[model samples]
Target: MKSNNEKNPGISRRTFLYSLGALALSGCDGGISAPVTPGSRATSRVSTSGITLAHVANGAADVATSGAFAHPGLLHTQADFDRMAQKVAAQASPWYDCWNVLIANSHARLSWSPRPQVEVDRGGSGAQNYPVLYGDIAAAYASALRWKITGDTAYADKAVQIMNAWSSTLQILGGDSNVDLAAGIYGYEFANAGEIMRGYSGWAAADFAAFQTMMRDIFYPINVDFLNRHNNTDITHYWANWDLCNMASIMAIGVLCDDHTLFDQAVNYYIDGAGNGAIAQAVYYMHPGYLGQWQETGRDQGHNTLGIALGGAICEMAWNQGIDLYGYDNNRFLAGAEYVAKSNLVQADGTYLTVPYVSYTNVDVTQPGFSTASQGTIRPCWALVYNHYVNRKGLAAPWSTKFALAIQPEGGGGNYGTASGGFDQLGYGTLTCTRDAVTPATAPSGLTAFPSAGQVVLSWWGVAGGTSYNVKRASSSGGSYTTVASGIADPLTYTDNPSAGTWYYVVSAQTATGESSNSAEVVAVTALQLHTYLTFDEASGTSAADATGNGHTGTLIGGATRAAGHSRNAVSLDGSSGYVSLPGNVVADISDFTIAAWVFWNGGNAWARIFDFGAGTGRYLFLTPKSSSGLMRFAITTNGGHGERAINGNVALPTGQWAHVAVTLSGTTATLYLNGNVIGGSTDMVFAPWRVGPAAQNWIGRSQYSGDPYFHGSIDDFRIYRGAMSTDQITALVQGS
Candidate 1:
């Protein structure tokens, strides 16, 4: 029988060996060789307008040759493991065991299977797995990693075989519900494996070319389309994970295909994309001493940690390409990483603290430490983040370091215990991120201050090596800076009681070394005024009273009953049988006004009005559901106009989940906000102004038109201000609730 090299003619054994030798020689000081730079034959095919592919190609060469930068460089090429194996009979590190676990699994799974059919399954709680897709990617990546680490021909051949199978088969991504996720999570790993093995001497040029076509044809489009659509103009709002995964996928594929535009697209979203992907949307600023809130922190720890891991993966890949995404946005990702670590890890003693989490129905619950968040599962996620934020950047992440140390001898994630579709980013960090290093503390940067409803909010950039921050405030700029807050953790934002005069603020970094110099001063002045406020904490059978001094009291009609609301008490409305009648003239005098309410909608798949203010059609201002989609639509028929001016919310008012929905109509334009994020808006409209019907017809949860829809959700703390509330005020309200 002929050898594998003899069977392939595109690349000879001699050429491959020479390339490997050159790769080994090029890893001097962990930088790429001069020939590998832009316009070189090695990266001529890929665009390099804003990003360079040299780092990726160099990492591959290093893996192929000296294996110096081989510690999880898309593919592992470290020869130290082989050296350790030669020196000791026992495995040198715990990572070796996990690596062996993958090798053993890949060794057992020698056959490759792929399907040519397309699947577009959508609209289920869980996603549809297509042709055992992610499983196949896992196997292929494991085989590729094993091949690079161990120099095993069989593993390399198996990985190539799997790639060949998928290239020739598999038509479409599996489902609709989480297609972006499938494309992102699976596409990233798949592309990584493909990128590594494309250099194999025995892999035929035709086969490699065909696989490239497969990636472009199948995976690339799915990610691009989902990312372009953003929210797809719907109420089924895409979470941060969806956007993060797609960003990861597009970026990985872009690197694989040498497409700079694609790479830039993903990075752009990471910086400024709206709703998701952007750091602002993913992180929540909190008071002193508390870790910044992860987007999924209130949801669960499994997702929270996974998000960190995946986001860290994107940053790691970018870091290899010479982009400092890890350190971007004042090291916000580090804050999220530490938050998850501190929330989930056991303390020095046996006892651990519980992290407070807010549920979907607006209920606050404390999650037990280390075990109960995300169903008490430990996802092998600490290594990458630890390596980047602590190991590489020399930042102080005590809790993250502790958690990574605790999950020692870290293993792959599949079936490790209970988690399924578990990612396998294990062991590499333990081998790579451990180093003796120290960094001096620096002053925090970008100190900023803004006034919100009833408070002055101050935020500043986080220092790289800081564990906590100190915020000082005073009424004057030159002197008398009192220590109003100290030891503020990551996401250095603080909310203080509003005083009548201007407030001056400055923040400093606190690390193991000491407190750094103070940041530039920032100032804020109280600007927001509440016109009307209703807590809806009325007696069971009485009227809903306005907390705002301006009397806009509402009479409970049709037996609307009092119950638990957003924070305090609420009033429940029956779609057909209940509604609240407010004084008609309460909102009649204001031209630019704001209406905000905390709603727990139970009106399933129907048009239901939350607020209606006129006696006939085309004569009222109303907020209602846009049919079965469950999205809220705010309409204003200016003084019985000919056409209704309205803007529909992009986010759905999900059933059973208490959501804060607010609409601000400034001049003729209307903007809708959900949970403090801008969802949608209408630009132009012509109407007379604000007006309401006689007393009986002006209602909450009921409309005056004969066939108008009545709301079936619980309403709490309904407020109508004389002027449109500023975005900052809306944000503060959502945070306070």
Candidate 2:
């Protein structure tokens, strides 16, 4: 809390919105229920948004899509197939080499037969019979690939036969908790195979219907259920792979069946779901050089590598559907992939390289250090990721590039190993995902601007040759431009503290040789964003002074005391009654706004607010880490809990740790962020400060309900922006960049 004015320097205005979004919080308060102690890996699930169509659409299916979904769009699109066919037709070096490997895989042979199971079980008394499912999944995909690449009807017939056998025979996925694993992993694989072969006319219309019925009936429920409740255990009890595999399956099925609802579920989950598979949780932390430490990095390399495999498949599927999950969060996925690749790939001497790691703790395990178990476990994941970021998009991934090349002509399912892990990815990435390298930055695009109380933030897309970016400003509409800032690196975000007036902004890519053309211009209507900031650095003070010029000093109440903080002294609170009361109407008038803070909590009582502002219990806007309905929530309400509209930050707050949490409202959408990353929130929040009237009970670390517990923790570096803060600005607030 020393001074957060220096935080988020790197946040420049950029395009906005990724999935971490709002779902409705149903049911009003349950009459002051007893406070539940949320331990490690606590549940962050807000609520299920929608049930998949799998529950109802279990009959004979139609042969056509809604025309919105692309055929063969799961992991391998038609374009990818065409590319492979072309490369192999010309006897291309790597493609041909990969083709050789595919032909040699026993699962791809015409003589291969499907071992149908009435019920496929992964755990419990069934003796781990999931192998039949995985092996058949592999054969189906390989046969489909042979059909697509070689135009062989025999392979198509074989693929159809394998698919029909399973569709007609498999009834239920049975087992213990591990059934979820089988549902997710093989579900995606089977759906991918069917997606490719769906266009084959040899696959009878009724036969395809049965296959669709099987997927929707047998797989989607398990996939959606695990994602919704995580076996009704702690949200973090299951690992990232568990979530990712399910997400992958759901997405593949959505594409294969053209069910937009199912498809959106997977996409939304990947973007903002509260589970470990979400982008923010999967790549949990970012180090310097944007090296994101993957969620399972400390668990072990095998699972960590599997995380990459499934994660890459999800991203690629999204990309094939014209969604850019690969570039979300400024290539954060790339950062994670690079970190994992560098760690798992060995040097020439078979020595593992060290990478930066933060200790990871969930409900079940505490990994204080990186685990080398199964280190250097190579998978077919690297090529898809490396090609998308470095070759297709013209970004850089040094570690990923080396890893992809090392395992060039990657093999899928059957070639990696006999286990299910070997088939996690469809492999043959070089045959399907490889693309010629793109040209470097010709000019930057996607420029945007957001203005607040005293500053304007500007951001733009990255270009190939962009070693660094240069920010330009103009008093006029287009220019006579002035170079205000130069040499900004990747994830370009720039804030200019402009004098009060309309301002235009643009950016250009700078390389070793020269600067590129300026990007399209954006206009800022206001000057700055910061309205009120409290560093909470005062030594043993009863009042927290406002660092911003707009006065809104807070009065410490109920024995609120000083504690060691994120930077300096912070406001500490007792669970019984301690809080900080703020000036009336502090944020009761602002339409677009952002509230952010750094808090260290003891992980105690429920319904403890980080901040609450309202006239009374019936009408208030509050942000709490332990909402009765969720882990972290920000809500604006007029009729108490019954009429609350909130953004649920579907992520657990690390107890005994200083973490950043922020909520921003722009238009009707409110986004919640944790530790500078998007978690989840609401998109249709109607309750605003103006709607809530003048808030008289504005308090920090206290709830409006008299019976609710006060937050047991410390709060520091509180900030409020008059206008909606962009992602970069909020990130800057958290990262102090």
Give the Cα lDDT of each candidate: 0.58, 0.73
Off by over 4 Å in 2: 1-67, 417-421, 443-737
TM-score of each: 0.54, 0.63
Q: Residues 513-624, candidate 1: write the lDDT tens digits.
A: 7888887676554433355677888656567777875666888888588888887789888777788887643443344557888988885545568888753442468787
RMSD of each: 18.3, 14.4
* Stretches of model 1 off by over 4 angstroms after superposition: 1-131, 150-154, 175-180, 230-236, 274-278, 284-292, 297-300, 346-375, 413-441, 445-504, 509-515, 525-737
Whole-structure CA lDDT of model 1: 0.58
- How much does candidate 1 score in TM-score? 0.54
RMSD of 2: 14.4
- The whole-model C-alpha lDDT of candidate 2 against the native structure comes to 0.73
